[model samples]
Target: MSVQPQSFSSLEQNTESENHSSSSQSWTIEDSEQTYQIQGWGDPYFSINRAGHITVSPQGDRGTSLDLYELVTALRKRNIGLPILIRFPEILADRVERLYACFDRAISRYNYQGSYRGVFPIKCNQHRHLVESLVKCGTPHQLGLEVGSKPELMIALATLNPLQISEKEAQSSLLICNGYKDREYIETALLSRRLGYETILVVEQLEELELIQAISEELAIYPAIGIRAKLGTRGTGRWGSSTGDRAKFGLTIWQILQAVETLKSYNKLDCLQLLHFHIGSQVSSIRVIKEAIREAAQIYVELTNLGANLNYLDVGGGLAVDYDGSKTQKNNASKNYNMQNYANDIVAEVKEACDQAEIKVPTLISESGRAIASHQGVLIFDVLGSNEPPVTPPPVIEEEEHLIIRNLWETYALINEENYQEYYHDAIQFKQEAISLFNFSYLSLKERARAEQLYWACCAKVFEIIKHQETINEELQSIANILTSIYYINLSIFQSAPDHWAIDQLFPIMPIHRLNEPPSKRAILADLTCDSDGKISQFINPKGQKPKDFLELHPLDNNQPYYLGMFLVGAYQEIMGNLHNLFGDTNVVHIRTHGKGYKIEQLVRGDTITEVLAQTQYSSEELLENLRRHTEQALEKNLISLAESRRLLNNYQQGLANYTYLKANDQESCIP
Candidate 1:
């Protein structure tokens, strides 16, 4: 068997009309939550509440649940419309705390002498509320910030003041300056050291090491330095290319030795206090991670043997987020281990390797940005509309029909699991004959239509016999997707989910409300963008199951507005987004959860039409002038009245000032 006994939803629509009503639906919150794999990816922080809404538990599931639907309603009442990015400072702080706690637990468990120093990488979700919260939350834990560019470093530096870090803690905290640094970048980092921030300039190449050494000599500063070794060991999954010999960053083995020799020549080997290597982000397997640690540890020992006074082994961030929520290691979006497992493995590997090499265990630093920031921000957008394929089998024509049409009807009538094999083959042959006869004008239009009706009825019956089978045949499983609904989402795919389009990153998406209602529709979300690629076709299926072609969704009642929330969108999505089709940015709201209720701390409106146009060199003044010229031309031709012309100009100006995205107006209001 390949399909379940349940036929097309339309077949059950009328029969289940009473059960489908809001107050009478029988679906449980737990059952609905399982459909979206809320527990798998959501972990300690997200779950279904009594109200059947997706709720946030910042301190984990045991904490108080904040209903997202309630938040949406509150925000709506406040006049802040959909397609909003919601930032949770509580979740942000909790992530940082949890990440640090894992390492601390591992350290205590292993009796490891060295402490863990977690650094928040500014490149991942570097929004003002998020980075500032990370800095503030990390102060007690002695967490640091890492930057790859000057602007990122500037944000880290400027935010430090507003952050709760004390003067002593700031002086000892690690401010890692990564990437290819120019003279200005190098000097800025060096200047930060003068300001008492413990900044380390991690050399990526021989030339960069030379630059640091030369700069240090001129400035009369014994600058703390680190070397990003190009490792022989490669990472696992999609980001592995960012490591190994093929990687864009870090120093080769020969280059590393040359850099050490150059530093020795400058009598600055003592300045080498950190040994760094990054095997890429979102590492899928702990096995590869342990191997990389073994390799990086050897290099660290060698550097220490060569008399470089290194004290820190900076294991650059790649703590996976389990985006698919499988909690498995098979895919790039998932990792096999939990936070404790990750910390324990890293610590045990470094400890055993260092103990064998007869060297002291160095302080550990992890730049795990994705794990910290991915849960902090969520992109919430609404389903503007939907395009569902016709679900019902067309009514059979009673008048004289083609032979093939009559045969298909007979086959459709006989379709069942007991004789499915025989009826399916007969129906397929009849459908092919009907198509051929119609193409050659041997069959009338009514005959072809009746033949299609019977053909669909046959297919629907075949599907009914297979959907719930233990293992559906690949070919049979694909048939159901043909009838999948195309949900027209309000947000732009390029602007909110660029990774989905660029790298096929899977983010958990589900409706915030109506978890108690059984979803009747299976859909693939299509965005408002004109490009064909602007859609979310692939979705996370159940554990050990293949990815689904369509996401199960509730039927869209035209009177009521439907809202869908895309979860774990905090990292990379914010910065990588583009103005594809000129769908300029969405609204943003900062949410902080408390004992009972959450507060809307801040609200940032998205770009207006004029603002977006200005980015492309079409200023409001220029657009107004162009409109004025057109109106004058029309006036010269006596095409309109002066009053009408004024009204037209006013409307055009208002359009320019309004948000580029469709606004929620009276016509688009949600029905009660």
Candidate 2:
């Protein structure tokens, strides 16, 4: 499939009023001409379109595009409730295959001698289903696994051991151990090697080298060692400092020299087989990666010349996934670099640097956790009630209020006339006075409300008038752009997209339906959380201005359900979700392409009341007994009837069967 440029329009223009035109623009996805069938699944499935309307065609057969509505109905029929997480196994396989193909294309293009092996860091998702899918899909490439902690190491060891390999593929893939190490961690890595799996303990600090040496001598087995170098080149986004001098992990230049000497002294220099460095997670720019690889390659060449045996260049996890669909540097959460470009640049730069230093190109390895895992999962949420605009009476133009009302009226008239400069200034002054009057109790509440509404209406009108005019002041145009509509969506920001709530990471959010119509409201998404901070103010704007507050949304039905899909959340949402308001995890369903259509292989229900209580160490049995005893006492005292007491106990016990949040429908019968 050929790559096509994606266009982003200003959030201001997506408003409802702006979309009222004869010709409306909508996003369309085309079907892929190529297809392949999986072993069990009959038809081939591929992502044909990623634009406004994301479409998936099974088996590259363009007979008809599979509607997401059909997929949702199939899930609902299978009893998958609201707030569902649909896992497309085909998408997961596609990502793994595409990543390998990209690197292979780059290696061939640059005539690079070194091989490329990718590792799916389990820390990103760590779900058994996802890991299993990765292991199955990645078998052809011998894909590796990266673990940051001890438990993760255990998981990797159990799952990736050579014993698990089929008869045809006897050799095990690589296992890289990252993060801080203690005696237990080092011993675990050694144990993994003892199990016949190739394990590399990446030394993040100089002291770790000593620990590894001590353990190796004690165990009488030399394990492979990887040293993470602190590269000078840093990325320019939230995760940028992950590699520079101030980075948390990796060894400094002085420490690197010391590590080499220590390994040589212990006669373990040959165990030093890999050099690693991480610039950050979600590396946006190709240039930043190119520079960092160049710097690290030179270091690799220098170490090779010093007689250190290093064959693997581990470019630590920074391959970014574009979440917002905006290809820009500021939005690093959405990448400016794609897989092909990223791989090409890495291979080309490393090859050039290694050739200059007269050293053989080392094997290329990436610990890309986000790019491989993010697209496979999606968070589906139901829109509850919205915060409607408070209804107020229209402005009563009395003789005394004539001046203020006319001034407001004149601004709108001028805006409609394309008189931008005077209209903008007057609108600002009128809005301030309108607010001041309300503060001083000079204007009634109704009057103040009318003034505020009129002020915004005039601002919108001014922008619409100036949108087609080229001579308008750019500064005033920028201000008018922000006062547009804000749509309030339902879902907890902290529970759903925490990075957006914490570090302001932007994710691609759009309505599930109504792609054909132009958006009508300038809106900001408001979460259902009770906290005042539960809102999304930042959005994608086409003018390269700061994200605006409001966005346009399609009209919603009061009785029907409305949903918003939070895409690219497969990485960290599950493990990171907190029990704010005691809202537990959402329902998860594994989706895969089947003979006729898509199928839901598994439906893992959300946390039930009993399960959540268990997490807090609450004994449900004890609680049930105590409640029963209390009810019996009430019956003995005649405070409640015997039949009522029995009914109450049964009702309470039955309610605890599922999650606390779910409503109970059936009533318990009394003993009578």
Best by TM-score: 1
- Mind giving the per-residue lDDT tens digits that candidate 2 earns over 403-430? 5665775565446463666777888898
- Each model's TM-score? 0.92, 0.81
Query: Superposing all C-alpha atoms, what RMSD in Å does each candidate have to the true structure?
Result: 4.1, 8.7
> Relative to the unseen true structure, what is the C-alpha lDDT of residue 451 in candidate 2, on a scale of 0 to 100?
75
Candidate number of the best lDDT: 1
lDDT of 1 by residue, 1-672 (tens): 122223544555555576467534567887877789988888788888887888888777456678888888788767676788888888888888888889989999888888788888899877787777777778878888999998998998888642335434533667999988898899888878877788999988778877887777788777999999889888877788877787899888988888888888888889999999999899988888888888998888888999999999999988999877787877777888888999998898888888888989999999998998898677887787777654455454443655676667667766777887668778778888988998999988877877777777777777768765777676667667766789988889999999999999888899988788888788999898899999999888767355778898898876676879999989999888999988887888888766787777778788788888888988898878998999899999999879989999998987886766664443234211
How badly does each model clash, as a count of residue pairs?
9, 21
Error of 1 at 592 (Å): 1.3
Candidate 2 residue runs with Cα over 4 Å from true position: 1-54, 57-65, 163-170, 390-490, 542-548, 613-672
